[model samples]
Structure formats: C-alpha cells, structure tokens
Target: MMRRVRAKKFLGQHFLEDLGIARRITESLSIPPSHVVEVGPGMGVLTQFLVQREDLDLYLVEIDSESVEYLHQHYPQLSNRIIEGDFLKFDFNKIFPDKFSIIGNFPYNISSQIFFKVFDNRNHVDKVVGMVQREVGRRIASGPGSKEYGILSVLLQSYYTIEYLMTVDEHVFSPPPKVKSGVIRLVRNEVDKLPCDERLFVKVVKAAFQHRRKTMRNSLKYVEFDHGAIMHLPVFDLRPEQMSVEAFQELTKLIEEHPLCE
Candidate 1:
C-alpha cells in the first residue's frame, strides 16, 4: 500500500479515501469516449479509478509540486496528461481545445472562486461534477424563493442545470473537513443564452444581491445606468432577488443599450 502523507492543508487538501465515493463521483460523469479533465487530483485515488475506464481520455491538473511528481512517477500512463499548475490559473480551452467534462475535489479555500472559473468556461465545458461545501452546493442548486438563492444561484442557473447529488461525511477524507461536503453536477443546456455581456450580468447580479433587501429602483443606483431608461423597466419596485432570470436578462439588455454616457 502507498504510504500517503497527511494531505496538504495549505492547498485545502482533503484526500478522498472511500473507493465507493470515488466510483460514485466518476459514475456521475457520463463523459463521451473522447475527453475529461480532473482538477486537484491528490494522491491519485480518484485518478486511479478514472484512468482504468477505457472510454475517457482522462487528464489531471494538480498544483502541488510534490503530488504532481508523485503522480507522474506512480501513474506512468498519466505522465503526459498531468499538468503542473494552479487549476484557477490554467486556461481550459487552451488545453482541451474542444468541449469537455470537468471533475474535481476542489480546495475549500477557493471553492466559490472555482465555480466562477467554471462559469467562465461553461461554453468549453459541457458539464461539471465536483465536491464542494454543502452550503455552496445548496446555493448553486437553489431555486428563486430559497434563502440560499443569490448571485451564484442566478448566474449558474442562467447557463446550466445545477443539481446537488449527495452529501459525503467529513470522515470520508484523509484529513476531515470541519463541515460536510456534497457533490454537484452542472449540465449545460443549448437553450441557455447569455442575453447580454455575461461579465456585466454577474456584476449586476452581485450589486443587486449585495443590497438584496432594496428594490430594483434602489439597487439600480449601485449599477451604472440611465435612470430615465430604468424607469421604463416593468418592475422597478421589485427587489433584486424577487425578480427571475428573465427579468435580469431584460434589464441588462436595456441597461447596456443605454450605458450612462459620461
């Protein structure tokens, strides 16, 4: 048996130990025979299971130099595919050069940031399956009326069908996390439309949620727009979270058409 050292804390490393969990995570991904990308592949527990499947052209991205080298030496078949770099900093489109599936046991420290990164590459990544804090998993899959619904709920729902699969106990990891974690899958829909500048959409969503209690008329003040044009919007009295995704698209479309000319 490989003597795995304590998972690196600095990297938010919680190495998954349960083979059942590993198999279940991979099984959740129905990747085509062509390609898949796995991020934060610590100690190659999941990597071992993933590569054995003949269908996927599996690739691994690991940030820890020690683990990267260890994986390269132990999993000789993956030597060419193992990328040594921060997953947050790497450009997925440049590597895969085609649509792909993404899976990971993301570091808890930057798990939310990781979602934004995946959102950016939603076009290139057909689906995302990963483990994250249970709260975050709930927020992503949350609906309009739920308290967990916010910027992430709005932004992610605009592009993909987000679903919380199942929760894993803290004892499942090498070094148990303080909180339980859950796996989620984001499947892209062809019908999903950006409707406006996606970057701007996120900016607007964040601004509104930051003052979620305020009505759109009040929240609109935070975002740059022609007050005159915004007055023409159908429901200026509604709060940001109260509005649906379609309303956001319409508002952003109108706002962009009338940027505040300095």
Candidate 2:
C-alpha cells in the first residue's frame, strides 16, 4: 500500500493515483536500459512502477523537502537518482548533460516554463513525455491558424515532432484538478535546419506572440529599433499569428543580417 502525503496547494500537488495510468505513463516512454528521469515524483506513486524496470535508469527530481525525505525513506534504491531542487532551476547539462529522455506528471503551474526549458535544451534531450493540463497540451500540439497556435507551438515545432498522445480524465488524479489532463510526447528533431542564432530565434518568436494581433511590422518593433531592414521583409503587412514558423525563421535571419542592435 502507498503511504499518503498531504496535498500542498502551494506546490500545486495533484498526485496521480491510478495504477493503470501510472503503468501507461511508464509504457509511453519505451524505456531502454539507462534511460529515464521523472520530475516531481510526488508520493512515489509513479516512482513505484518506474523503478521496477531493471532496464530503466530511473531518476527522480522533487522540490518538496518533505516529499524528498519521504521518497528517500520509502525507496532507498532510488536515493542515488534523487535530486532535491526545482527542476526548472536545475541545470539540465549538469544532470544528464548528454542526451536523455524525461517523464513526469509535471506541476501544472510551471508546465509552460518547463516546455521552454526543454526547448532551450532540445539538443540534450532524446525525448520528453509528460502529463500537463489538456488545454496546454492542445497549445503545444496546435497547428498554424488555430487560436491555440502561437509562439510556443511554432517554436517547439521548429525543433520537435510533438504528438498529442492521450488525455487523462480528472478522476485519475488524487484531489483531482478542475481541468482535464493530457500526455504529450516530444521527440527532438535530428536535423538542424533552422538558420538563426538560438537566442535570436527565441526573441523573434516571443515578440511575434507578444503582440499576436499586430502585423509583422508592428511585431518587429518589439525586437528591432530601426525598421530599415525589417520593413523590407516580404511579409511585413502580415499579422504575427498569420505568419508560419518558416516566416518567423526568415524574419529572424533578416534581423540578424541588418542587426537593429548594432
């Protein structure tokens, strides 16, 4: 029997309780020997299923000190894999640094930020599978022209083949969330076809979505000072939301060549 841990609203704790769901989440990873990292292993509910796979190099990261202590006492074999810190602030390069896969029933509050973190380190991650709010999952998997489609969709799509794996009903979670949840799998693009500085790419994507209703010309203002070269872009009159991921890439290239910064 699993020991109960008090749900902390401040931490956004909604522990997954369904055993079948836990197994399904584990199976989704297609775990190979020496390949697994789970974030926010609350109560070791999912951890119980994950560590059983001898092939998996299961590791857990928990931020709640009490929960970490609880995990330590309950699962001594997993102690080496346990790291106590905010997964967002934890250095990916320092953790597995090289390429590895990650799984979790992530805290919904910082789920989007987690996506950004993974995007920033796409090169280091082989694949990422996690359950986040269903609405967020839709946004990440959203296509161009959908209301849900914006910077995140475009930015992530540029580097990954995102799949909307499955949706879990609210009942699956203990002290269930008001919203439905979903599982998403992101596999990093092996081809490095995007042609702009990673930093500038982020800047361009954020600027476009910052003023989603604005045209390319107006959006460029968020990132550019002088409009000399920016105005010359072929799609300057197009709204940022109307532009495709490729267009954003082209615009970033233009920004680089004419450097409004320099």
lDDT at 159, model 1: 84
RMSD score of candidate 1 (Å): 2.0
**Residue pairs in collision within model 1:** none
lDDT of 2 by residue, 6-83 (tens): 788888889998988888887877745655779999888778888878877888889998889889999999888899
Q: Which tens-of-lDDT digit does each residue in 71-140 have in candidate 1? A: 8878998888999998889887677777888888888888899888878787777888999999999988
> What lDDT, from 0 to 1, does candidate 2 have?
0.83
What is each predicted model's overall lDDT from 0 to 1?
Answer: 0.84, 0.83
Candidate 1 achieves a global lDDT of 0.84
Provide the TM-score for each candidate, comma-separated.
0.92, 0.92
Which one wins on lDDT? 1
Candidate 1, residue 209: the lDDT equals: 86
RMSD of each: 2.0, 2.1
